[model samples]
Target: MNKNIVITGTSRGIGFELARLFADQGHQVIALSRNADPIRALDHPNLHPFATDLTNEQSLKEVTQQIKAQFEHIDILVHNAGALVNKPFEELTQADFQKVYQVNVFSVAQLTQLLLPAIPKGGHVVSISSMGGIQGSMKFPGLAAYSSSKGAIITLSELLAEEYKEQQIAFNVLALGAVQTEMLEEAFPGYQAPTTALQMAEYIYNFALTGQQYYNGKVLQVSSSTP
Candidate 1:
């Protein structure tokens, strides 16, 4: 079945690969990113690249408005855009925290809320979280802001699942382990992760296709012992 899928941060990394996979599978992909060149380079007819800064309220509003105008219902929404600020808790300022939250929390909340009208029953919402945000886990240094933002996403998804069950909308968060993406590399230099962006993208694409049928309000942790 051809589904309407919206993905964020499609300029590169896991989101980019996901867009490619979805388009290849014949689904309509609305790819949102600050830069649309990479998405446009895909040259997939099913891919519609929209350049919009997720952290900017006006930009998000315009994109969401355009989406609502064009699509009656969004079958899937993958919130893969995130910001990571690596600084010691004490070194991190209010502005730093706000910047991370703007992309990881506020913008996601805003976009999802605006797009809800276009998400009918059976719609699935998945946000990419991090293992750092997983509760009761080993804490990493210099990741307080990023981890907290992800934790908020997990909580938000759980709450949304319960609140919108009547509407049959499903919400989930994927707490990803270190994937060999720019974000991971930036956070952990000279470290080789056990997973690659393409691998993670494949995993997410499969889950987005049928996750609602079996899971909601679940935070699935994905990782391995070795690369």
Candidate 2:
């Protein structure tokens, strides 16, 4: 059956691929991103690309408003937007942490809260995290802000999952390993990751559709290896 889906960070990378995958499959997809041009260029009837700044509460609220105007219920919500500042802890400023957290954690919570009413009993909220955010996982340098923010969302999802369990809405986090995305290229120039954005998006797309049936509030590490 066709379902309504919302995805963030659709300007590029996994979010971009995921939006296309769902829309092409006849699902109603709301693709949110700072730069809406990429998704907009697709011009798919089922895909609605909205310009959104996840760090801004008003911006996120507006997205929910648009959603309410269009769909009766949301079957899936993917918090795929992220902010990464690859800098040493000593060099990282308070603003850097705030910016990263604002998008990676705060916005996820804000958007989810706003869209909660529109999400039906069996809705799935999937948060994208980094493997570096996982406890006991290998950590990298110059990612204190990015990695920490990712970790925060993982815990946030867990908490939300528990809080909303009775409502039957499943909240889960996917801690991803290195994927060869533009973000990775910009952060670790010249480094190659085994997985591509499309490959990872395929994984996320499948999980978002069916993973909730088996798990809720769980953090699944979706990764091949670390670089």
Candidate 3:
């Protein structure tokens, strides 16, 4: 069955690949991004690109309103947009933390709340986190803020799962390892990861499509030992 889907940060990287994945599979994709040109350039009939800054409450509200008015139900909601600031823990300022939280945590929670009504029973919500958020055996330096924000995403999903259990809305987080994306490059600076954004997108797409049938409120860590 063709399902209505909403994905954030679809202008590039994993989000862009996820949008393409769903559109190719014949699902209706409402792709959200700060810049919509790349999404529009895909030119997939099943893909609809909407540009909005998720950090702005009013802007997010307007986008949600448009979505609510246009679509009767949303089968999958992927909160893939995030912000990252890599700096020493002492070098991080309050403003930096706020900015990271605004995109990585606050916007996701707010958008999920607004779109809850549009998600019918058996709907799925998946948020992308990082393995930095996971309790990795090896700690990563200069990622305190980013890791903390990603960790919050997992907890939020867990609580939402319990809170909305009756509705059968499955909330899950993918605590991804290092994937080859611009975000990864920004954080690590030239270091390459074994996984690519397209590969991660494939895993995410499958999980979002059938995850509810198997799991809920789970934070699954995806990683590869290959350096």
Whole-structure CA lDDT of model 2: 0.92
lDDT per residue as tens, model 2, 74-179: 9999999888898888999999999999989899889999999999999999999999899898888999999888888989999999999999999999999889
Residue 63, candidate 1: how far off, in angstroms?
0.6
As a TM-score, model 2 comes out at 0.98
Residues 135-178, model 1: lDDT tens digits = 98767889999999999999999999999999999999999988
Which digits, one per residue and each the tens of the lDDT, describe model 3 over residues 84-191? Answer: 998999999999999999999999999999999999999999999887777543557888899999888999999999999999999999988889999889988889
Q: Enumerate clash totals for all models, in the order shown.
A: 0, 0, 0
TM-score of each: 0.98, 0.98, 0.97
Pick by TM-score: 1 or 2, better one: 2
Instruction: List the pairs of residues colliding in candidate 3.
Output: none
**How much is the lDDT of residue 41 in candidate 2?**
95
Judge candidate 3 against the unseen true structure and give its global Cα lDDT, from 0 to 1: 0.92
Clashing pairs in 1: none
